[model samples]
Target: MGAFETLEPEDPRQVGRYRIVARLGSGGMGQVYLARSPGRRLLAVKVVRPELARDDEFRRRFAREVAAAKRVNGAFTAVVVDADPDGSPAWLATVYVPGVPLNEAVAAHGPWAARSVLALGAGLAEALEAIHAAGVVHRDLKPSNVLLAADGPRVIDFGISAAADASVLTRTGSVIGTPGFMSPEQLVGQPIGPASDVFALGSVLAYVATGVGPFGRGAPHALHYRAVHEQPDLAPLPPEVRDIVAACLAKQPHRRPALAALLDWLTTMDGSNEAPTLRLSEPGWMPDSIARLVREHTSAPLLHTPPPALPGTPPETPRPVPGTPASVRPSAASQPPAEPPGPTVAPEPKAHPAPAPAGEQHEPVPRPSVGETHSAEQRTDPATPSPGHPSGRRPRLSRRLVLLGLSGTALTAATVLIAWETRDSGTPSTDPAPEPGGKSSPDGAPGTRRWSFATGSGVDSSPSVAEGIVYVGSNDGKLYAVDAGTGRQRWAFPTDDHVGSSPTVANGVVYVGSQDTKVYAVDAITGRQRWAFPTTASVYSSPVVADGIVYVGSGVKLYAIEADTGKQRWASSLDGLAASTPMVVGGIVYAGTSFQLCAVDADTGKQRWAFPTSGGASSSAAVAGGVVYVAGWEGKLYAVEADTGKQRWTFSTSGRVYSSPTVADGVVYVGGMDHKLYAVGADTGKPRWTLSAGSEVSSSPTVADGVVYVGSTGGKLYAVKADTGELRWAFSAGAALISSPVVAHGVVYVGSRDKKLYAVYA
Candidate 1:
């Protein structure tokens, strides 16, 4: 039986004013039923599970939750139409919006292009501002709570964090907040505030663009470890959105810009004036779902009609008939010869001849020799029969000729049948190609191989593709810029040490860091050094540019440098070293180091707030919606509230996760020392899927065009289907590939431990 059925027996068609129409879906605590009110209004009712109803403490907390939810204005949230927390079957009801969840929309529709993303950001920011205006904090702000209503966006399930904020409220011991979505303070059972909600908002934004949440998935322990340490991946986001999201996701509560300010910034964005729309037809999650459907329904083929042949043409050749041999006819020399009726000239046999009886014996026909026939023809007039071979006596009794003719006719029929059967046996081949500006490629075919490129040695760093250029750093101490379309080397900047850091290009400048203890700003067009900033330790962190400042990390300090001058404007010292890069949004810079993640002032690099991690952080941080996701070397993923540095929840991995976390759709993608790639829910931190590779993964990941590209210490790079965590393809190098892959045009580019740069094409 299904889990929901075991918890609540399917019975009474109605509850209170709602008449249950159907069960839309179920979750750990209850079932969500699509129902209609007595007034005939659509609503979604959530009835608590039987087991959870037995908890008196849960009941009391739930009542409080209901009361708090009722206090909020419904304009920015789902209208709480009714509730019966004290009833035999505790339940809550809200107006049902026809639109899908933010997660579902991104998964089914795909990442919103610039406009939609901005509008979404602005709307969510406004919602958060309203929520903050009220006295309550939405501790569990994930993609699920933000529904994409047709009119606008609606935030739901507010104030429930207090009911089962920790595992203590239920027998399952699984908290209410999702691991990747919860803020750092919340994960540690700390007090949550409005800033925490902003953090979650950041995460929501990340998922919309990339399909994954900020922190990756894992068990509770692993998740907690990450919450205490590590940074979320934001490389998959577009340059403009990344800046805003990163700031909102700052680990420090004070560092994050106020929701009111965030809303204004988002509104003024280039695309915010228009509604959000996807540049590509579908988001990263659509292809994965379609692929799953294809595998399940293999019995039926997706067929297409063949295009019309030239103006006038023979109909298509029919398939061969079954049980017929598809081979050439027997030689004419072995067949019986027939006497000429009138003239000596003879006709050639057809390509297909009738088949002879399998076991039948045929009589041989006697005929004049070739020389005799020729002489007879010469002696006769053109149209007259020869005297020796009169029409009445010439070949009237040649049984062999008659039998041979019959056999040839049979052979011809058999040949036709075989052709028909052969064609039927093969897979159907379509003639028309795919349409342009559609889901399919230019040729209209699905699942076509895409192009890939290799840049720099030692792919331990993630790659950034933008403005027609693919930028990446190599262990060989060189940062290379390659053509996004052709994969040809456009420029290579050699550094003093290994370039294990990725590159970020904005405007006309390329920003990258190297182990040489320096961050370089170079001309995107000329590859000339525009400026460089020296650090106290090796620089492995990537760079993020926002407003007029460039945010990066080195050792234990997060620095904000001038975009045009590369001069350090401010620096914040941290408790531990930072390998992960910082995400800049608004005026805040979010980053992690060792066992702590924090937010710094983007303009002055002043410490705003710091949240300690149980383990050190190695992965980069990602911001979206309003949450900050950071993965730790200790095998934990943390979701810290962007504005307050509060812990929302924690999810754990089987092993340490060095690879940065990338967020897309509603899932989080992170590679671990376990050699596994994981997808976790952005709101609940629940496991969606996991895939195993051959070795440890140190390289960060990036999502583009529906594929997740990551490299491992196993010396291989993999392109995985984001939804299913299935490896679509892998490219093996002679040495470990620590560098992440970048996608642009139709190609993916990465560097390996080997000195060579390789390019793979569709």
Candidate 2:
């Protein structure tokens, strides 16, 4: 889920002194853009939201914090490159750290191993020591705020959290933090300090060691209660670090262990009292899985290389970065080629880049086309950085990452929940990710690749098929429509940020949600946005269209809107964020919330009943045979009565149940992190059969004609016997396949982390 999208009309061409190049993503604070300084240096520029800029008190506090933020120079922290606190619209620029966010990494891959979590803790503890030394309290230190750079995890946005805590916008006494990660002091409005960060550190470690948060997921108020009165659930955590995490989560700030103590425990893991500074570069510093990520993330550009060219096609031309010299740009290869065959993925010899322009400034910035990247020699660095690295000195990052526009996802406790998602129905996703698999050509083994369509970045958002066209969203902030038969682009609709919520099509209209905090309704045929419904938070829940209404969830509310008008029909509040795609069956919209599974009336948008799950419901409810089956982060699958929201039985899995279930012939089919696809009795919640996939199975399974089709992070999609859970055949996508498979007309369609959507022969 990494790549840049071209700038838009609404985007500023220049923010402060940097000339904007491309749009990265949006947050609660404001928009983040990739830009270049006049000296031709790259910078991640974050423009603050106007409302926040208008607050005079906020300006004063922000300036103070920004100045203090400058003094924080830590090995495991992002550098604060620059700031414009007094500008008409405040902005901040820092050397960009191109890596995955900790939450996204954990959810994509799975929890870190015990030792890896310990190593991570040490780095964060050291980072805290530096920030606290600067007298800056990281009020909102959570998974999203921590970026897993190549060398180590970098704690970001530490400067802005304290300013947000003091802001009048959050209301005088309301503290700012994520629901599950906030310390009790922040929840109770007690004075906060560095100790609060330690508490959050504990929560982060628990989440990293075990996928679920320590206190469980729920609404803000519920989290507050649990933080104050309930004990963090550490049952699933590895024994090695359980005590440390428990101490960190202590309700009383004074009772929490100091950073030095935590560091001491970490350094002495091998029984030595010596506290040696940690380096991810050191062997065993992190798991092999994460180490691979560190190598690729730090050594390569955030954008991936383009798919290899096919024979008889135009020569490959790397897209050039705006304002870069034209010599490295396209020449004859720039010409468009004839339409490609219906299905072809041939390899072309690699071509060397042209010479740079005379007296060029530094290296020319190559801007490849969407879904394209430079050659091997070009990807040697993490793009151009202002001397940023996790080894020692960190290139400073601006305000909070989004300073002003920290999308609600990263700003406060306003958002969360995930795996991967697809069109309205089926399961939602959660896990660990590593693109250990390679891109498969048509001539490759297990040659079932009918064709593959690549997007700008990763393809976690599943594909939605409609009228011979497959509609999919990308982390590149665009929704793409491709020819189902030819694998050719039909049209593309761009938003301000990434589009993770899958698309649902009905009545010639495509409905989707974006991290840009808007639900867009576009012409299904033209890819033109018809209207956008704005929300106060990002829309992680995919939209479901039924009758004339579009049912979707954003933040903590489930909304029903007029399909044609883009106007809200009604909004129903929930206990927490809406991460699950809505499932509409029989006039009822069933959705999973942070703490419960909710069934809402399709027309009135009123909750009929909310069945509270022991853990957060990570997947959407699947309704069949009068039963609504759902998966929970607590590692259990629940069989609840569709009509009454009462649990019939709960079957526990050895791992988290992020995959949604599919029922056929009185058996419920589900997959879990245990690397098995389970077939259980629909009525009994007892196992009928299980098929080990050899890797985590986060992709929900689709059942068709006595066969179950499911994708795994192992980079393969397996077709298994519906009755016996025996494998029939498997197709490899060469990357993790978190997107659920869709089967129709004898073809199985799946999206992969490789940034391609594959049409396989079923």
Candidate 3:
């Protein structure tokens, strides 16, 4: 975390509209204060000191700094949140850099791993790119000026050197430079450009990798002498990054790699002549020791309750800054994907039935044959019929047609599988979801509102949270990574069609299906496409990632795709559309099809067994205690043995069952068009309890902390007592609550027809 100090009596309790809470430190311009906005946002507000405020020239310079800071907006650099230049004491507030500075991190955690150094370089390069594009140069680039946040490294004190007039340094009558990090050109007082930052970046990275400056610490004059005339001590750097750091430390700036090329070089540290994508937000990016320090700052409540009074803590001011500079510090956390607790119900994916594709129109056929067969795409030869079809002569129809004829519909998690529980892997996330039950903010109490993210269209897709980012899809045909806490959009990846499939996060990649018939593997941190596996028809099925393989359904086939490569390992042809999200357990994948619940080999994609059923399988399946629990379009919840595909029990609901089942503590929970959420005995298939939602219950129920969190078409999210089916509370959304509610860290996330994703208390 960035350094913090107790507020002094001299510090203002209020800066403009910001409520000053504590002292950040002293900078050249004046004292820096940490403040909070009414919106609950923590910001760093820089106030001009009385001495500098009286200097008319300093006011102009401070004004320029505010404008310049506002112009340079980058993920790795501070973002100016608000500023007031003409006020009594001109102040500027920017997003806080909450993590520890590079110097402190190195000193505390020893040295970072090679990859961390590379990540730092990439982050710094990106910052430089943004700063230079805004026509500003951050001449003061040093270890103390770089903050290592959970998301990535952040560069601070940018554009301050440019904002300062040379006379200010003369007025101090003392040289002001962090000598170890100062570039040769700046040391010799030669005119500097953007490349000057590159030299400083090299020194910072060298410090991170070796825990010492390349120029060796000494007096400012000796440090400058070594920087301008000596070759940096690069022998200590790991070979993977040594050459690149050497290139950045080139005495002549022209020989250094451009910021653009610097990132390209960072990726190919192995000298393989091939650049592999590196995701900096991966779990292991920062060593466990240092990452814990960052997590503590990031995961803590957004604002620290300001002490009752300014304590005797020392100020964190730099020894000297010639011209006043803004000091802002805000913290961010690493987002870990929702690994839910207890049993979780998977929401039924939405089935699109109207206006079928011209070539894929439906035709009247026997009910059994119509519901249990493959799509026309798989039956390329008209003379041949899919053997999996109950009646070989039955015509092929899209999966949607089967749904319209049998189950009707439910989804945007009443639509996202990676939309629902263990959607992609089918393995239930345990314990983690309930951990936040205690000591959570009142905002997380039953039905309390937190935030909502508006999308281009309804967000039917379920959301996945990981590494401080929330991954969700929208009918808008874009997959958005949003800040789970702030509801701010981080990035959006465009798709050709609606992305109704819920996202599955594994390793450092996010996998999901699109109606466009492609399953994409994306870099979780960067939102860049790593690979796309093409399919034959609309892929309404969400993906389950396991053991380097991505298992998903598209049309009549279950595909085992190489997670890293877009290559298909094998495709298992089903007699009917395998539209349900697949769940893999014990090397066997359990998935529902229009005609039956199919068991396939996880490795070879070979069909292990298929259990025949009437109508079709409309919802995804859940497995627990050696049995698979799946809901049928015919309103039957079937409990079948996972290994043999033999039925153990069947519980019939009042109406069609589109909501997937969640098995926890020997109880199977599911929703139905009958407007009820039911808890059935997993072994006996006997109804334990049922809560009438007052509207159709399409979204699946997620059980955590002895409660069931579910959504209804009536647009309300309900928290019910798991044991007795007692309703604790309900929160109304703007539209249909068709999206299955997902619980993570005491918060419930669900999408709605109102084109928004709501985060409420669980």
Candidate 4:
């Protein structure tokens, strides 16, 4: 029975040691109760399904989950105040948040306005970043898991799936997760990490803005299949939101921008800081652009569930209420089809013939060569069935076989087609120019605006500007070089895997790393491989050049090589991995490792000094004013004396700050997982100004022509005044941007998760 079913046998007064005050809700897991602890603190307690509690593996997993939950801090997630996973009938309890789930909020109140949606999205991203940092993943994240608290949305049901132990049971032997919201890998039972939550958040945000999931609905398995193989339907959403969601739903989990990326994108959306407009005006008040979107989305065969009712509040019959104005008529087209019982199952599906083998499905009948083809008129004879059937009618199938196929097999193309038709509303045409004048640069500045060329993928790597040209590699596996002034492609070289490491150009050679586990030096002008260096693991660190030496790290080893010869000079083993590029300054090669900051001699690759850090460092170090500034995976930004390697000061953030720091004019600028770009005093590490992006900020900062430019996972590239970190201008991209921004000539160049490189001018 659904959670809406009324149950009244004097409603249990107590469960275990807690006194039940009221009903919270119910699901497959059993009923939830609003209870109070001995201390009189209100809590939401979920009773486990009887069958699940009896399973040994399930119980063990639940215990493990409880252990994990105990490790989590309550700042970002709903705190687990108490639980009894070992109870005769297991149950867990968390603080009660008095508000409707986001799903219900949207259903009862209409889709959130863009700014409100952005706020919600940003909050979720922040929560995910925290969860991931704590080494946990919220496998099931939908609008229902988000509580719209008075101050901000609170992430609830944390670690619930882990409590289930083994994956949740689904039809067809599939593992867990909501069909429409699960990431591709999660659908296939692959271990998921933070990226999975990022994907789920993308779906939730899409639903918030467009009243539909990113993927159109169908059977659970079908949604799973599409999630792994097909792109999301984002036509109804604004490009700002659509791009980030698309990035989150990338087929390859690693390709999806991390939670930080998504947070940054939402934080940078225009008008995100504005208060949500409350008064529901006319439907027409939603922009004509969006109304056009409504018309298109309404055309699709999407399905949605009714808004959930408040805890302890039974569903009442619909009746016109006095005092509040009520519409005498339906204000819109008929509501979408009611959601089915389980996302995994579909109701009464139509049958379709199985497709032939892949190669034989469409042979084009082996058309004759153009010159020897028959006359057009003769070739256009009336169509007819082939000899086997003679008639077009299909062969009659036995009733038993048909029943079996309908009951047990995957849905056919015909069923998918039906779902597609229903789910497809006309998508608004947002394939327009992003903004007037692309990113620009001015002359005589330390950083000049250069020509920005499209990379067709996320440019997580850094750009190397040399020889009047700039070279960089992309997640798409293509290394591109463009004329610094003209923005024309010089040439591009393709590699075997994601080219996330930036190219280092020197002595006619361009050095780059690839996810393929190899570093290659290519001809700067010709884009032809000159030499290839294989590594035991993938290379994500950009190369730093100094004094005829090229220093780079792959996995956990830092290699110093001869710049012109492409031969190794020395290799040093480090305590942990380094994912950021290294900075070579004053004969000391400074690079960040997962757990420490190491300074090595440029020539011998011998460690000069090392500073131990409790948290891993994922970003490279910035050197200026005799200080080294770097951020870590642990949410702290540190300033170290460049010469002595002694830590000067550290500033803490609510979320991880993985983006590398940019030092300019006595201030250091960096993006944080906390969804804010911070300007800290270069000497003391004190925050000067913080411009909250409302999403993760993973992209490194670039200061050019007096403006500091950076991109956020939230899909926006912001230009702020270097001195005050004041907002100057921002350009929206199609997806999360992990790529560091490049200011050259007069244009700002950055790559986004939307699989497109963007260039905007201020």
The number of the candidate with the highest TM-score is 2
Least lDDT summed over 10 consecutive residues: which range in candidate 1? 413-422
Candidate 4 Cα misplacement greater than 4 A, ranges: 1-432, 435-456
Q: What ranges in model 2 sit over 4 Å off? A: 1-140, 143-258, 261-417, 420-447
Ten residues in a row with the worst lDDT in model 4?
409-418
Models 1 onward score TM values of: 0.42, 0.49, 0.45, 0.46
Residue-level lDDT of model 4, residues 1-762, one tens digit each, is 012222255455566777665454544344676666677676677776565677666677776676666566644467666778899778877776554455545665566667656766776777776666655677777766765544456677665645323333221110235547878766444667777878888888888888767765332223443576578888988766777777877888899887665666667773444322221122332334434433443343211222334788653322221111100100110111111100000011111222111221111122222343211110000111000000000010000000000000000000000010011123232322353243444442222323346666555444544455656666577778765545667677887766656554445566666656667766665566766667645555655445555566655567776545557778875544543456556677666655567787766778888765434454566666667766655567788887888889998877655566666566767677667888888777888999977566666666655677766656677778877777776665666655565544455556555555555554
On residues 124-223, what C-alpha lDDT tens digit does candidate 1 reach at each position?
7766666555555766677656655434567766644443233243322223454356666665445667777777777777777776665433212223
Task: Please report, as a residue range, the 10-residue window in candidate 3 with the lowest summed lDDT.
Answer: 333-342
Candidate 2 on 1-762: residue-level lDDT in tens? 344665555567667777777666554355677767777776677777675576676677778778878888988887678899999679877666666667656766889888788878888898999998887888777776777765677887775655324433333111246657778766544578888999989989998888877875422222444577679899999988899999999889999888888888876663434333545546676667766765665554432223334776432333333221110110001000000000000010121111111221222222223443212110001111111000000000000000001101000001113331222122222221212232233443332666778788766565666567777777677888877666777788888766656665555666677766788877765566677788655555656555566666666667877767777888876654555665556677666655567788777777798776654565655565667777776567888897899899999888655566665677777777677888899889989998988776766666656677777766778889888877777776657666666555566777776788887777
Considering TM-score, which of the candidate structures 2 and 4 is the better prediction for this target?
2
Q: How accurate is candidate 2 locally (lDDT)?
A: 0.60
Q: Candidate 3, residues 1-762: lDDT per residue as tens digits?
A: 333555655567778877776667554345667677877577778776564466566567656766776788887887777777778888778786667666666767788788778766777888888887776677767776777677777777664545323323322111224556667666444567778888888888888888877865321222444577678999999987788889889998788888888877875552333222235555666778888877776554443544334567533322221211124421110000000000123222221111111221122211112232221111011111111110000011111111111111111122211111111112122212222222233445667667788889866565665555667777677878776666667667787766656666556566666656677776655566777778765555666655656667765677877666667888876645565666656687776765567888877777898775444465666666678777765577888898999999899988756677665566777887677899898789899999987776667666666777777766778888878899888887766555566666667777776788887876
Q: Native-vs-model 1 lDDT?
A: 0.50
Q: Candidate 2: deviation at residue 103, Å? A: 16
